[model samples]
Target chain A: MDGTPGGLSGISAPGRVAAPDEGVTEQELALAARNHGLPLEALRYDVTPPGLHYVLTHYDIPATDADGWRLTVGGRVRRTLDLDLDALRARPATTRRVTLECAGNGRARLTPRPVSQPWLVEAVGTAEWTGVPLAALLAEAGIADDAVEAVFTGADHGVERGVEQDYRRSLPLSTAADPARDVLVAYEMNGAPLPPQHGSPLRLVVPGWYGMAHVKWLRDITLTATPYTGFQQSVAYRLRQSAEDVGEPVTLIAPRALMVPPGFPDFMSRTRVVRPGPVPLAGRAWSGHGPVTRVEVSENDGATWTEAELVPDPAHPWAWTAWRTTWTATPGLRRLTVRATDAAGNAQPLVAEETWNRGGFASNLVQRVEVLCTTEATAA
Target chain B: MDGTPGGLSGISAPGRVAAPDEGVTEQELALAARNHGLPLEALRYDVTPPGLHYVLTHYDIPATDADGWRLTVGGRVRRTLDLDLDALRARPATTRRVTLECAGNGRARLTPRPVSQPWLVEAVGTAEWTGVPLAALLAEAGIADDAVEAVFTGADHGVERGVEQDYRRSLPLSTAADPARDVLVAYEMNGAPLPPQHGSPLRLVVPGWYGMAHVKWLRDITLTATPYTGFQQSVAYRLRQSAEDVGEPVTLIAPRALMVPPGFPDFMSRTRVVRPGPVPLAGRAWSGHGPVTRVEVSENDGATWTEAELVPDPAHPWAWTAWRTTWTATPGLRRLTVRATDAAGNAQPLVAEETWNRGGFASNLVQRVEVLCTTEATAA
Candidate 1:
């Protein structure tokens, strides 16, 4: 994705600022930020801190004792093989920075929110994932030609649809074997061994796909000629567009962008009074479809659009790209809207209603930031 | 809904029990219980503790300075009156015990879980609410004959569906004025002034209705000739049965029951293993339609249902009724299911899939409790 840089440098100001909202006080913002596993304030840089990454788990973090941990490759393989943690680690390592997002990230913002995790737009983050290439391990196992899909299963298990089973998903055998896809059997995150909450000993890191495909606390890989009809695979993440439609299996993440919640830099302000003159807005944008090529900002409720300057960070191409824009301050309640376009031509929708799915999957709607600016007289 | 008391006395041995589930360990259960604002161990009491009541708020809780707070009655009313907290308390006071449940409760159990609050069955509790009857307040203001609905507005405000407005809902004037409905302008919860999280100073308590109808932090009562089409009223809580159906507004709580998550009294047990033979199970049952009259328990996945003994607690008509049953144990994995029938003849559904709503509202399916028991030799 390519974009012409605007004059405004989108970097956040030094120190921390509370999220912008008329209802939220500084104290509440701090608690909310802490609750989200991120600073309430937008970061000075675009790439999120590894520790601050958002976490969502259907089950508790598996207490994986690495000493006894093992990975089994079987099913349609020419030769079954089992490897321990050390064995997998010794076979050549690679690290890639990638953005991972929950499929239900923005589900709460949909016109009709479903009855599941009330995730806002914060259920996404980027991190450097280190592991051996999944393709390399698959090659060692020697997949049979008739294999159709590769099933990856995690240690986390729960009951769904009257069936009790571990969390599992299957990718087409061709996609699993594609070297360019950068599929990984990750054991490290951000240069550190994987934390328990993120998947302790081993996990799958599938770039470009939603987090569901990256099964955490991974333990087994089975290849089969038939498509796997497991709960999470065929039933859970289906993107049913309408009542009559059964929905297709959800895959790649959609293009999306988010601005730091607008707020005054100073905590002492009793009112949301923005200083008169040019106001700089900073945030991050990303796309699993492809790199974000352009991000448009709208101050008049999408009545008009202006391009924001994109901050190039080639080191983490799969991570979110930082962007900033300046707006002339006017004394009134202001609502800022943002939409991003990706290289794959997917654009964030103006409204989520059009993209409604039964399971509330892939809800990438235009983000809105509301701010109130008071004149000096009103502020006084 | 009435049935003859069964011989099995469902009284639970005193104290709390962990929820029976193969997947959740004791540690995870504690964390979950803490997150839900409930006691770490599920109790046998039919009435829920006020402090342990579950809470879910769309906007931050309003910091209410009670002295300055005022409730306004206007719109289609003949006279507009501004009443302070003292003025409300000065009027006739009434008390009622009501069970309020979030519409999104039991959402996580849906096979294709929606994206909202990951509420299990814990999103329900009964509390004794003391307040001034709303009908009396509306009478003082002189409701106009042309008024179609009485719209209630809370002080809390936020941006939802791209609009900045106070959280609001409108009830049909007939429903608001019906004395039998027992709608209240509540100021006290369980004999104490309302807690901030439960809506300080004033809130609405609509007995026999979903929690959404009980608007918290209430500030205004506006009578209107037309129905209120606010974000929460028309969109957020609408129970869309399918993509094709626009769905009706969700209201009354459904008939349902839940036993303490079956667990041992001692925390040392790593696995949920119970001694073989007669096992007693106890829980509470409720319904917004009317008092629960019958509760059925099944350990064989609905193959054979047995009646549970109901403890009569009719003093609090709106409160849940305590029930219990004993099941003969076998040395194997056991899935226990419970269902309740309300006085109005509404029964908890056998399958939530049939009653699936796009927003996942009013999901009151039978709860299944899974546990495993081993022979003495295997256990040793």
Candidate 2:
């Protein structure tokens, strides 16, 4: 496993400087230097820390070094075209605090789990990816429906026949124009030139999709009537079902993220002996789909349940929703259960999946905790 | 963010030595001293590790030096269970590797997310937990089938009116005897004396459920036809339908822990350049369910697709299934898609989830990937 050493853990850096993105005076290099496990040192107060900022590179960093960074568009287009860095930047630009997660971010958790770069959950983080939208670029190219897909190519190299590798990904023209997808051919990382570890020079930023689609070192673009079958396209980033059907197996999704809710601090099925006094049952709940509505705590394992008061935070939609409810801790073993409801009022499930795969990709079963009993009086 | 040492992260030990559980040697420690990342340094290679050892203390370790401990179980059983450590250990023992995961392990990832511990996928792990099965203990106690829920309590203290705390959770009787739901009153972890952090002395271990129900510091066992209404259960771990649902909020389940097959890499749109050499696609897949039977790969997103070779393990029903595929790298943007079919032929959903909770629980979408263009020469 390539343990890419970049956790917010044990690491040091130079002095602090002002960050262009959040208007915070923090040194970008130092912010990115915090080793894994310790996010506070680098993450500081920057809403979008420059160094710790996320970068979705296509392949490795580019070799162009910006001498002639350019983008080209062709095939079934009203206007075949090419644009340099200056011309690209001349176009309109926008940014938002979207979280970018490598599709393989948590893959390590799987047992007999293949080793990759040792990334903890921190591999997934929020960043203000800024760039010109692909739709605007497509408009410039005057894309057509016959062109079923818009292929993105990067300066990154992969050894095909042991030669140059140009990482690429294709999207449906429909998706390319959705505008809601917010796909971007980006050139900046948190208001700075992209770092080498991140995609340097230029890259594409496909929001809401796994990090793979945000090709790094972007260098080429093409429109195709049929889907492009590249190495990555034909192979990587896919999830398989446990069993197959008549002809072939099924294909999985775009991208999805999960969150924690109430019944959190105290996982389900835990046993605890309450200390004599009034205690609070609290937890946090949130979702990638939308905002959370309420979170419930049940000490009865789902028989009789209660609602915990949720702390409101409009600014924390992408963050966690904290909830609290007080309870009287009586003697003897006690059981607790917590669950959450989203703004859509969707609740969490209660069963572990019965499906099996070679790698445990998305194991989102009901979380359970086991606590035991004891009181202060037992000390005597 | 009192950090209160914080979720499973800040937990550490003094490196003190003590008699570990059965089969565990002082040199062998499984659970990590720092992170739950595997191949724990504290271990020296034994069936069980000393540090990763399980614990089920009847009292909170914070209130006292706590060497001598006592546990008591009462209610609905032929014989009430009350005894010190020695007496409890004297009971019959059984061993098994049950995966224990916190419902909040992936909690921090949700948007509009809740405030809770920052648990990574590592929040869940499998161990050869050794103990007297809670079923066996209950059998000895003469459990009553009329019992609705089997509630458990722990010694960890939760804030009470803004103070310290004790953690707790409970389970349904159906869940209690589920062969799939293996609950243990464990005295050994990985085959050694329980660590102080994990439940020590004796704790209730319920497999396949959220962590809360597997109460640590277990001192009591109560089987009641009517459930217990503690703070954790009534208010936490409950799932409501989407807020948009037109019915009264329901609390069925937000079952987590789904797995994808390994070598199940996702590929999205490919590039425009056609390359003529063989390229490889790889990934892994697994789920909380059963084993995988098929994994399909599509070079054209969901259009024309091909079946990849499936590889699986024999030992674990819960382990991931690894897979790989080979294809021609034609230069062009590629759309790579992969999905799994379980033993029952349950395919990975193209859009596994239609509903998302505020807590962002249960998100199982299809997997996709994109690749770049390669020339025949490069591919060759």
DockQ value of candidate 1: 0.01
Docking class of 2: incorrect
The DockQ leader among the candidates is 2
Candidate number with greatest TM-score? 1
Question: Model 2, which residues run further than 4 Å from truth?
Answer: A1-380, B1-67, B83-88, B105-123, B160-165, B178-180, B193-198, B201-203, B241-315, B318-355, B366-380
Scanning candidate 1 chain A in windows of ten residues, the lowest lDDT window is A1-10
Position A62, candidate 2: lDDT: 35
lDDT of 1 by residue, A1-380 (tens): 00112100111011121222222221221112112322223244355544346666654345478999999999999999899999999999989988888897766455554434445576677788999998998999998989988999888754333234578899987779898899999998888788665777899999989988999999999999899988687667888755456689888889888876554311111112354578887788888888899998998988999999998688766788888998887766677889899999989888778777767788898877655554322110
Per-residue lDDT tens digits for candidate 1, residues B5-122, read: 2100111011111232222221222122212422213245355544446666654455577989999999999899899999989999999988778887776566555544445566
Ten-residue region with minimum lDDT total, candidate 2 chain A:
A24-33
| Tens digits of lDDT, candidate 2, A112-222 | 332222232334455556778888889888987688888887665533212234677777777676787677777776676665545657777765555667777777789
State residue B37's C-alpha deviation in candidate 1, in Å: 10
